[model samples]
Target: MVSNMAGGQPPWHGTEPDAPLGALEVYAEQAHGYLGASGDQLGKLAGLLRPPVLESWLRSLRGRVDPMDALDDRGLRGADLRRYLQAHPIAALMPLIDKLLVEDTAATGLMVVVADQFGRVLSVQGNDERVAAAAEVGLRAGDDLSERRIGTNAIGLVVRTGRAAWIHGPEHFLYRMRQITGAAAPVHDPDGRLVGVLMIAGGVRVARPEILALVKATATAAEMDLLLTAMRPGQRDAARRDAGRPQPAARLGLDVLGLGQPQLSIADRRIPLSQRQAEILLLLAEHPEGLGADHLALLLDDSDLDNGTIRAAMSRLRAVVGPAVFGSRPYRLHVPVATDVEALRAALDSGDVDSALRLHAGPVLPRSTAPGIIDIRDELRVRLRIAVLKSGDPGVLRRWTSGAEGRDDAAAWTAYRATADPETALYAQIEAKIRVLDRRMGADATRMQRFGA
Candidate 1:
């Protein structure tokens, strides 16, 4: 609790159980009850809470976070937290934070929280009592406070929008958090990429307008310090090293599906790859155990392809992505790589045919006939086809029969004919298309028989 606010507490302020609730807190409580209430209840939130808070509340609801439930979600700990902190660029800025935010807040009994870009609490500092109170509710170092877990909060809001935010009193989504107030700001590096968030919090301080401003200013100073550190000749190497590695900020995804040239996505940037490079990446993604150059060469081609060619390709691929993502000896991805194929499979597994179909572009790589790629392409094609056939939904069937991959698939058309109303003109169209395909196949067979030398 904020035992002391420097100046006297406002008339509306209430920390004890006996004290009357602040007007804003009372309204905020009403807003919480309105969650899942009909129409204007959602609309009415705008009149009650700030736009940011309302938006965050809606987002938290969508993420399936229950407002009344408190989370003890402390996953980032032990060796993992240590490694993450060591690799994180913000670890070097700790001294500056201590001087600027931590030391000054010592008297206020306000806790200073530093969260990584993903909203995992890295450190929590304050008076011993305040620190102990924070830990009891799992707001300790290594605990996840991201929207994905604890939902609407100051640190999570900053993480989501890359902007400063403040949540006061009942503005917090979790019931246990209503007694606290927080203001958080995004802390970025020299390149303007968000590395983490800096936050300050205390007992339900309802009207501390200066908190947001102070956090933002501190964040700006931290960014400037990062710039200065990068500018220094002696510290430049460290900065460069951090730049080469993926920060807690960057979101990585590999786009290998569809007919468009395959691309590797690093945060917002997409780096297009050569067909061979894409093929190599796809194969590597499939085989997480790591493939030797010789084995990878074979998967890339049916016949003998030299290992030196694979090494050269790997080198080029490493340069395109960062060298940090790759590992030698057997050659594998060091980081978790999410792909479009995996997304499709996830949707299918969850019975979300609509999303799965929407996600399906063309084949995994329509033009690629590399031995391993062919197997993968056929497997995905079969999986999608089977899913479409099983789902007797006419909309799904029509969608399948309409796509370039599914157009030639007779089985899909047959399934469509079985499920769809035969009275429609679409049924006649399918009949004609199927006949044409059959005749074409027959003619190809005749040609093959004639050419049997």
Candidate 2:
């Protein structure tokens, strides 16, 4: 049996004067009763479960997760899984993990499971029999072991809490996982950010307090290996120099153009942004001088919202994009953000019509309904259209007139008519389109006059 050398009292105490095993059994029973009972009964039975475990259980309850639900094994597989492993920062630690845990515990019916920061298991290794047994419950690679999917467990808890966690049989919130026990520790990159989780899991027979320490030590060693690998012979000098100087903040690429959802990319990691956050970021990007909370609220919504609401939203955004990128005082980006809209504007300002046409993906945040976003979108559209119409290049005018944005634009058709060869069929097409637009405008003007009368 593994000794409890970490110096904390065990999670449970038996009511019947029995040994540790019997006490654990009684504790498990009480925990189950507590979970099944109403919120009022939790206070009375709180002592039966560890503080961390109780907190996890409460979160699970809030999420409306069922304790008896089967584990969800949904994630990248085959070529996608291989590609993910190759690009993941934790890939370098796989050899060390295999050496320390997989090889050592293979014959002992123990499995070493490694998961990304999101609690998606990337790899699982051990003895054939044990590995197969673990797979029966969906503990293999490409499975989501997050608390939201599988209820409270060591892997999910470590990812959520960013600390070492231990969960033995009966302590697990899931009835199906009651026969298993596990210890998990968060793996960190050289900069001390959580990169993944390293866990050693097995049947209850092999469960021991010492497993937590083992997993912690292994994770630390793997991190050291990764740090050294990053500072190889050629990069040692540069890495040392970089370490001495303050590192530059990472850049965020915001793509708000077109009808598709806006995407935010930082360090090659791309994530989709909600329309509200996209609008806020776009406005902030436009006004580098920054805007106060009241102005931001006015731009974001017509309804009245206090500064606190905006502050809370900014806080949540900072958590995702990092504080270095999203700044507070007046509300502006601290780090440089490159947006497609800005790129197109720059190309146009430089009088590079060809480059500007190439850069313009579509209207900026076309589907956005925010008042500020609408204003900026219209301004950009008008500026680009005017710039293209003023350019005398037949090729540039032809490209613009053919696209959806310029198809019905009267100015674009007029520019095409002035630039295209009179003998060409393309010139006839442009003339026909101009006549159609003229008729549409005349009908609209007549309807407006009738309405006024």
TM-score of each: 0.52, 0.51
State the lDDT of candidate 1 residue by residue for 325-408, as single tens digits.
768889887765667776666456444565579899878888887899999988887778778878766778889879887776
For all candidates, the clash counts are 0, 0
Candidate 2 per-residue C-alpha lDDT over 91-112 given as tens digits, one digit per residue, 9 for 90 to 100:
7678888888888888887888
Q: What is the C-alpha local distance difference test score of candidate 1?
A: 0.74
What RMSD, rounded to one decimal, does every model reach?
11.1, 22.0
Whole-model Cα lDDT of every candidate shown, in order: 0.74, 0.73
Give the poorly placed runs of model 1, Cα more than 4 Å off: 1-21, 40-43, 205-207, 233-453
